[model samples]
Every structure is written in structure tokens, then in C-alpha cells.
Target: MSDEHEHQHEMPATHEHQMGSSLSMAVAATLHCLTGCAIGEIAGLMIATAAGLGNGWSVVISIGLSFLFGYSLSTLPLVKVGVAPLAALSVVLAADTLSIAAMEVTDNLVMVLVPGAMNAGLVNVVFWVGMMISLTAAFLVAVPVNRWLLSRGKGHALTHEFHGMAAAESGWRRWLPSLPTGALVSVLIAFMLGGLVVSIADEAGWQHSSSAAATTRPAQDNPAALALR
Candidate 1:
């Protein structure tokens, strides 16, 4: 009975280690989502600047593409590991898109509202710094919110189901998936896209335009003329 009690005691320590592993996997998954989102968003901004696109259009394109690419980053890995294409695609899209969209909206709002950051041309150090700072701050806020959602098993639940499936499938699987690697690759892709946009915008002579102010008509001092004349 004592030996059985010792064995039971050891089980919890083992479970604790497994729980730690799960936590790491969860974190890696979220970070991957963040990386892909950051890249896609920055690239969108750059493309808008280079193409002389307005803020509205740039933001829309960036959001759409960011979500698409972010989902793809996650889905590709799972699909490669023999997960069903339809299921993998479904989960990644659902899990990462909401989080990415939330981050994008908040972070971009900061960039647009910050003084000297708006349409402020593509090359200003101050503008870039402001955008980066805003994004970082947004990320800090976003992580906990996302983590809370994940704890409920709702945020990353989709992708979580795929972790063990990689080993469950048969030989000659065409894909290899890694949460950490997928995240890194996605970020790199976004950075490259961003750099390209900046270069093109620089070459094409895109510059910030101060919005024109609306003019108001002066109130009629002619009211006196109407009464008298």
C-alpha cells in the first residue's frame, strides 16, 4: 500500500511536467499568430504608402490580407502533418483571425492618431518609432486578453487539437509542421513585404499631404443691411 501511495504521488509531478509542456505549446502558438499578424499589417501600410493609397483602403487591404496569411501560416503546418486539410484550414482561420484583427485595429488606431505619424510620408524616423511603440504597447495589452481567452480553451482550442495528430498519421506524410518555425517564417515574410513597400514608396515620390481645412462663411453682418436698407 505504501509503494502504491508513492507511485500515486509521483504521478502528479509527471502531470505537472506535461502541463508545462502544454503551456509552452500554447505560448508558441500565440506568438506565431502575433508574428504573422505584425508582418502582414506592416506590409499593408508600406504598400499603401508606396501606391499612394488612402488610409481607408490601406487599412482594409492590410486587415484582409493579414488574416488570410496568418491563418495560412498556422494551417499549412497542420495540413502538412497529415491533419485533414479542411479541418486544419477551419481551425487556423477561426483561432488566429479574431486575435489578429483585434490587434490590427488597436495598433493602427494608435499610428493614425499619434501626432506626426499620419500620412506622414514613408521615411520619417519619428513616425516609424511611433508606429512601432504603438504596436508593442498593443501587443502587451493583447497578450493577456488572448491568454485569458485561451485559458477558457476557446482562443487556441482549434489548433490545440492538432498538436498530437502529427504523430498519429502514417508514413510519407508530405508536410512537417512546427509552431515555432511557422511563426518565424510568417514574420520574415511580412518583414520582407514591408521593406519592399518602403523601397517602392521612396522611389515613387510618395509624401504626406496635410489635409485641407473646411472653410466657413462669415455670419452676415449684412443682417444690419437687411434691417436698414
Candidate 2:
């Protein structure tokens, strides 16, 4: 056989190695998408629940923010490396939108199907439990999608092919904080929990103030009661 033909043929070992690396890349891509989704979904849900928005509005807000954050995570690094803002955004849009949409849909559907999950409060375990379940489902669903895209050289492959070199050359990565996959997920969870605690405290304090005001108002309204006390 000619040299080109020989080169095109890969041994089983090399094929297996490529497969392993591709699988790892797909998982990492899914996790990156997951982190962005987690931040947006939690923040949107919390804001929606706190404001008493209906389920429809909550989903809308969540999806909007998910796209915003997802595209942001991909786009920002490129922009920092001197990629034009719009070009970076366009690449990220093509690279991330489908994955993000799939994730958001899967997670939101889980939330809706879980009884009372949409209505659950920030402090409620039910809300958090549903969130965990939804996010896990999103991750599971997105992995295969990302894998398929990567195989076609359509997903993060696009990023690796374009602008990946510029980012390395610019040395912008050193200036940015890098979180491992597990640590990134942990940080997102901590953020959600911290918000939950702060919201619960604020609500409790407001309720207490309202109750005290109600008690004092009645005493002030009735001089006899005040005098008797």
C-alpha cells in the first residue's frame, strides 16, 4: 500500500486511545456546560421564587440566564485573548446553544414533573432536592449530545480548532482562575446554598419586624391597653 493509505490505517491500540481521549473531552465539555447551567438555573429560580413569579415566567427567566451564562463562560476567555467580542460570541453561540438548550429543557421538565418543585421556597429542602435531581438529569442528557457533536467536529471541537491557539499564545489563561470540574460544581452548589441562607434570614427578619409592628400598633391604638400594660 502507498504511504498515505498506510497512515490512514490505525492500529486498534491507537483507535482505543483516541476513543478514550474523546470520551474524556466530551465529559469535560458537559461539565463545563453543567457549571454554567447550574449558576443560571439556581439564580433564576431563586429570584423567581422570591418574587412569586409564575412557573412560566420562571422557566423563561431561567432559560434566558442559562444562555447568557453559558455563552459568557465560552466567550469571555476568547475575548480576553483579543478575539473580537462579536466573533467570540458567534463561536460560542454555535458551540454551546444546543447543549445548553437540551440541558435547560431536561432540567426544567424535571422540575415541572416533580410535585411542588416549582412552588418550593428557597429555604425548602424540596426545592433544593428538585434542583439537584434536575441538574443531574441535565448532565446525563447533555453528555451524549456533546459526544455526538464532538465526533462530528461541531461542538467544543470548533473552539479547539479556532482561537484555541490564540488563547495559548496570549497567555490569558494564567491571569484567569481555573477550577477543576469537581471544584467548579462545588462552588456553584455553595453559591446556591449561600443565597438560600441569606434569603431565609432576610425573610425571617422581615416577618419578625412585621409581627412586632402589628403588636405595638394595637397597643398604641388603645391607650387603655397601653396604660394597663
Candidate 3:
């Protein structure tokens, strides 16, 4: 066989990589979406929990804010770069709606399913622990969805073209620093983890306090101590 013929006979198994071929890219997009979702979810749940709202209202409020913040975060960058407000919003709605929906559904389900999580007040350890758990679950659920959409040149892929739009813009928007989506995502992730640590510490301290009480209780006041005797 000629070299040219051999070269032309590339295997069918070989395929070109697509936009979402990078797992890290998908992760970054998901994290970007998650930053907004977490803010809305946590805020809604915190408000609902504090106000003693029912689970239904809590889910409704959270879902509403999830879309609100998700669209706002995605839209603001475009608007700052001189895309018209309505146009920016239209693009964002198309770009982030599905991702937010997937995240919100998964997130709300976790909060609803976890025992006493909904009723747990903002100050309660259960609430913060639950917040961490819900966001983690939502993140896991959304990554795959974003990856699927990106592979087809949809989802966050739509926004990729606008990445550097701010570079050429000059005006009042210049005074408004570009919002760093990745930095914001990192902050939200750290907050969730911090809450998790606090919840764990709170739980451990309560357990230790209970154990200490049991160990040091006066014999006469302790039914268990009397029984052992």
C-alpha cells in the first residue's frame, strides 16, 4: 500500500474533541452556575427557615432565586461589556436556564428529604450541615448536565464567545470592575465547607458534653450509676 493511502485510512474510532472535551472546563462551568445557585438556595432556605415557612414555600422561593441569581450572574458580564440589557438577558436565559433547573431540583430535593433539615433554623447546626450537603449534591448532579450540553456546543458554550468582550469596552462599565465568576464560585464553595466544619465541631462538642456529663454525674442523681451499683 502507498504511504498516502495508508495515511488516509485513519480508524473510525478516532474522533475530534469538542468544546466540552475538557472535564475541567465542564467543572468550571458547573461551578460558575453553582455559585449563583448556592447563593439563591442558601438565601431562600435561610429566609424560609427563619420565617417558619412550609417546605413547599421554601422550595418555591429557592427555585425562584436560583433562576434569578443564575441569570443575573451570567447576564451582568455581557451587559458590562456593552451588550444591551435585554440582549444580555436573552442570551443568559438561553445559556443558564437548564443548568440552574438541574441544580435547583437536586438541591431542593436534598433539603426536603433530609430529616428536620427544612425546619432547622439558620442558627441550628442541622441547617448549615444540610446546606453543605445540598450544595455538594447539586454540584455533582450539574457537572454531567453541563458536560453534555457543552459537547454539543450549547449551554455555557454559548457564553464562551463573549469571554473577552470586556477588553474593548470603555465607559462607565470600565469603572465597574469585571465580575470574576471563578473567584465568586470559590468563595461560595469555601463558605459551604466552612459551614460544614462548624456543624461538625458543634456536633462533636455536644457529643463530648453529653459524654462528660454521663461520666461525672453524681451517683445519687444518675439512675444508670445506681443501677450499675
Best by TM-score: 3
Worst lDDT 10-window in candidate 1: 209-218
Candidate 1 Cα errors over 4 Å, as ranges = 1-27, 167-229
Candidate 2 local lDDT, 161-218, one digit each (tens)? 5544444444644465434558877888897677567766777888999999998898
Q: What is the lDDT for 1 in model 1?
A: 100
Tens-place lDDT per residue, model 1, 195-222, is 5567556645533222121121222344
136-197 in candidate 3: lDDT tens per residue?
A: 89989999898888888888999888887644366766665556877897788788778767
**Over the full model, what C-alpha lDDT does candidate 1 score relative to the true structure?**
0.68
TM-score of each: 0.63, 0.74, 0.78
Model 2 spans > 4 angstroms off: 1-10, 162-183, 192-229
Where does candidate 3 clash, by residue pair?
Answer: none
- TM-score winner between candidates 2 and 3: 3
Report lDDT (Cα) of residue 162, candidate 2.
52
Pairs of colliding residues, candidate 1: none
Task: Give the lDDT of residue 228 in candidate 1.
Answer: 62
- lDDT against true structure, model 2: 0.83
Per-prediction count of colliding residue pairs? 0, 0, 0
